[model samples]
Target: MTTLRPERYSATAIALHWAIALLLLFQIGLGWALEDLPKGAAQFAGYQFHKSVGITILLLSLVRLAVRLFRPRPEPVKDGRAQMLLASAVHGLLYAVMIGGPITGWIIVSTAKVRLQTMLFGKIPWPDLPVGQGFHEPAEVLHGALGTIGIILIGLHVAGALYHHFKREDVIGRMLPGAMKSHGVIGIAALVAIALGIGALICGRLLSFAPANLVTPPIPLPSASSEGDIAAPMESTAPEEPTAVVSESAVSSATATPWKLEKGGRLAFTAEYNGEAIKGSFSRWDATIVFDPEDLPGSSISVTIDLASVESGDSQRDDMLRSDSFFAVGTHPTAQFVSSSIRAAGEGRYVAKGTLLLHGQRKPLTVRFSLNIDGSRATASGNATLQRLAFGVGEAEWSATDQLRDAVGVDFNLKAVKKAR
Candidate 1:
């Protein structure tokens, strides 16, 4: 009058168990693949996939735990107390890692100094844990340690399963999809070997890789003189006091005598991060200048810079600069500088009082430059110091001046030819 207890796992339990297992193996490979990839878009993508799979395993593990609590399971095989306890210990540790691994990973990302937003599979937004920077180091150490522990536990689990299947012929079928009676030891062993081989190959390649192209050329620092042209280098001299704020409407774009911007110019910036200098530059930009050294009142200059073109030698750092935490190029793709007035600072030096619009914020900027005019060409070289935080260039933890300094020095060298009037 009563139903009998099944000799194997329920269909639901079997499905969750195998699903989590396969994902875990794939996740391990992905983690290794990240190390093989260059520190650019490829590595970033691999990390995202790893995160997605980790989250998936975490969810599935929870479901499996719930099923274990509610659903009936198979009876233990008639192994001795010591062997049984050992088997139980391995299963318990496996579950711990299946759940703890993802939790620790999540913690690492959440408390990261950069504070980047986590997007699961690039679609669903995952929120960070409301933990402080203090937790970041501990979580990172634990996450890596757990990964090593998980690998060991997985090997033990597989060996134990194979032992039961081949020697005692008792408990192996309980979690198998079909509850089949037997599997060829050779076939199982070959599959295990292939997986291990692939894993080893990935690790080897990652360890041996030396990225030759990863080294981006250092930003060219302005020099005192170049060729026969009189090129002035960046001077520590400060510009004169600011004049009236330049209104957007008052900044005239149409200069009577416009100087065409020639190629071979550089616009670069330098900032300190963690006591190390980070130098980078914008590859694309346009400028409009109307100036007759004699007519200072009518002179005006405007520059449009592509924010997405920032290159800092490091691809990962470049990506971070483009993200919302820095330039937010998606929202503000370009930055602008409009001059309100220009005045002579020295015999060959000039200061252009203007406003710089960056990261959707506007702030006053003074550009101190040296101009040397030839028959039909002019070469100008100078530098400006900008407070990045004033324009919201760095958000979250980056807003702190200690790590990435607030004062970013901008250096520029421009060459132009007078228009044929």
Candidate 2:
């Protein structure tokens, strides 16, 4: 008793083969589309989906290989020796790419600069490869090279199948999903076209997928300024026609000098993202200062910042920062600080203790600043460090400080002129 060779592959093998093939084409298209997308929540989700598909291809390819080994397979087409060798080489390379591509991609995510956890389809958490940082760049290069090779091999495989279905008329029927006979030339062309079109359509749909349903409010556009001034000056002149009855009781007893903020003032911040500095600035803010260097008890200062006016040079990142996960500007559009006390620290340095209201949280803050007065014009610069998490700026998964650090540095520079009585 002997086992007779079959004319068609086992149903299981056929299903896996077609599944992996379709996935490979779709994956390649997706990889290219990822580069075109802006850096934001939408792109992040797209990448996760790409990873999920790659993992799926790897599992299915492994199962397909197992089936080929244990189960009886169709006899190979008795073609020329050269054709047989070509087919064998292509098949071997395809298998290598199918397995290696996803592994390299996993390594990339594991050792990424910004280590984000891979969530499969935003549901199942996939563990990263146990790898180190230096592996990321090489793996990325290798992954891209493999994708290029895979595309070329797939084209060759498709061309071979079409040739056999037409010229040889003996090879393609074994892999056909069902008893689907070609009606004519139109039918054969249609079959090939469908195979090609499926992946493109899938890729297009994935690229256009909408982001999480979080409303990102529009930031008010700041007025234009010259290169010398980053922030537009917030100053207005008094009207000449105004005449009112004198009210000496309304004025304060302390005769502290009022300083008007001049142009070229800047309010900037720096935060660490994966050990890299992300620099940004608030374009809209106002300050009130009444100070006397000799009379610290009579001096005071206050600041109000429009949080929605933050610009980090990245539109997507700016949008994300304005969203609920971070600043949540829609809920708390402004942050204010009112000084409780001011003391002279050194010859030119002063420290102002204040209460800062940010992200709906109020906390004590100490600001150290250096002041220089030249006749009536004055210049001041200061810096402060604040914990973003403490103020409830980062919510949910974003609250974790591994990717984005907790401590953020805020710095400001301003020029002012004394207001006449």
lDDT of 2 by residue, 1-421 (tens): 8778777788898778877887887888788778877655445556767899999988898998899888988877767999989988998999999999999999998886544556666467778788889999999999989878998888788777777766746566676655654536435744875566565646644666353232232222111011111111111121221211112332245566667778778999899999999999876677766776766666666677767567788966776676556775545667876666667777877776656678887776666777888877888776778888767888688888999988888888888888774
Candidate 2's C-alpha lDDT?
0.70
Best by lDDT: 2
How much lDDT does each candidate structure score?
A: 0.68, 0.70
Relative to the true structure, candidate 1 reaches a TM of 0.54
Could you tell me the TM-score of candidate 2? 0.53
Root-mean-square deviation of each candidate, in angstroms?
Answer: 10.7, 14.4
Superposed model 1: Cα runs more than 4 Å off: 1-4, 36-38, 182-324, 327-421
Cα lDDT for residue 299, candidate 2: 69
How well is each residue in 1-421 modelled by candidate 1, as lDDT tens digits? Answer: 8556688899999889777776776666566666567654344445656787889999999999999988878877778899899889989998998998899899887876544456676567777788788887888887777766777877887777777777756565677555355566444643664476456535533532222222222222111111111122222234423333333443343233557768889888899999999999987776766676666666767777766567888876877886779886545667877666677777877777666778887666767777887867888877778778777778677888889998888888888888764
- How badly does each model clash, as a count of residue pairs? 0, 0
